[model samples]
Target: MSGAAGGALAGKRVMVPETRELEVLARMLERHGAEALRCPLVAIIDAPDPAPIEAWLRRFIATPPDDLILLTGEGLSRLQGVAQRAGIEDGFLAALRGVRRIVRGPKPQARLRAVGLGADLSAAEPTTAGVIETLRAEDLHGRRVGVQLYPDNPNAALLDFLRGAGAMPDPILPYAYASKEDDARVLAMLEDMAAGRVDLAVFTSTPQVRRLSQLAVPDRLRAALAATRIAAVGPVVGQALEAAGARVAVMPEDSFHMKPMVNAILAAIGTPGSGEAA
Candidate 1:
């Protein structure tokens, strides 16, 4: 079959969850003839003080720590820029000279490799739960660890989880929020959804769900989300949608990638699938 025949998102009205992933996804949507809407729920920024992070790198000059955590691809990308701004480019490279980096998953690992940093380890799953599980198995209780945080500035849940799991190593957030930027299309997308102009909405991140709560979308627009067909790529995104009062229309098995998820949603819209209460 051709791409359009195999792609579920073909000609469907869709919503993008975050600005970071929008351009590429939007292009993909268009290639499939889908009318994609842009609505970024959160902004991602460089961490504060490129200096300390650079300094953090110095300690790794020789044999970098046995392990480091790469939480998000966005975080990893920002860290590189943060290092450059702090004039610690050389130090940053030295610190990671040969140390093994444990990224959240394939995407983050891909980012590392893109920057010439090879992955030491990558979590089996894409969620925080997967990261913790991998860390636990590696016995991080006493090892000093580095972490890249999420854009929303979530309260160090990973740190707490590590400590609770008997980890005593220092977990530093090196960079704080400096790369923050909201997706400009959020409100318009919401309006479209509210106007019943959208047939499907796709989400890759949960922050999009949280950010909508912060938007000034009228109650009617919010109600529109509840009535529209929604599809989340994974459990976390689905949970966030449900919490926001929008039921999930489809979450496919195994294929968490955006294109596949949309395909699954379209398949289900025409066939029977697991749909949450609206």
Candidate 2:
């Protein structure tokens, strides 16, 4: 059910709410015969106040922690950039290498590998639950753990779990979500969904779902979701869509990446199923 070659999603209008990979995602859909709607709801930006990250780096350099948890590749890259900006990139990387590294997913793991470092532990499912379960088996008692954070989603559960395991969790939020106030564009997209102009809505991150929900009235968003099928990139995004009262109709079976997500979307479109209840 390839979107190209007049595949399942051929000529279908799909909404894409992503900033980081907007062009790639949209173009991928367009190649498959989808009129990809680009509506970026949130922008990923470096934290306005770099003090926290700066301080964390200073502490990391001074006293390396027992475990370093990397959540997102972007966060790791941002950390590297911050370190480079501070003229301590070499020291920062060295300090990170001194500690045991645990990665939440493949992204962070890849980032580490790109820098000639490797993760001691990697989450199997690449989610917060996976991270917690993986850490649950480890001996974290009286250990200091530094965590690199992603934007918008505050992983309180992971932190609480660490604390419960007698580990000191120090999280560094490397980025923050800045709202994209293109009301005209967003409203038009929402209206298109409500009018049944859009056939699918693709969400790559949870923050996009939250920001979209906040921008439009709940009832309107709910109605639009009811009319159109929704596709999430992975379990995390799917859960977010569900929480926002959007029925997630498609997701990848494994490997929650853009290619897999596009394939899953096409498959779902080809073989329509009884989508999850709204």
Runs with alpha carbons beyond 4 Å of true place in candidate 2: 1-8, 271-278
The 10-residue segment of model 1 with minimum total lDDT is 269-278
Per-residue alpha-carbon lDDT of candidate 1 for residues 1-278, written as tens digits (9 for 90 to 100): 11244344455677766566777767665555566666656555555555565566555444466567787676666666766775666777667745568877667777877877778777767778777777777666556666666655553677897668665434445433321234356566677788888887877877767767666454754686875788888877888778787888888676466666756755676334423211
TM-score, one value per model: 0.78, 0.92
**Residue 223, candidate 1: how far off, in angstroms?**
1.2
In TM-score terms, which candidate is top? 2
**Model 2: per-residue lDDT, tens digit, 162-243?**
9999999998999888887587788789889999999889988888888878888999988888898998889999898888
Off by over 4 Å in 1: 1-11, 48-52, 59-63, 153-155, 172-188, 217-222, 269-278
CA lDDT, candidate 1, residue 80? 69
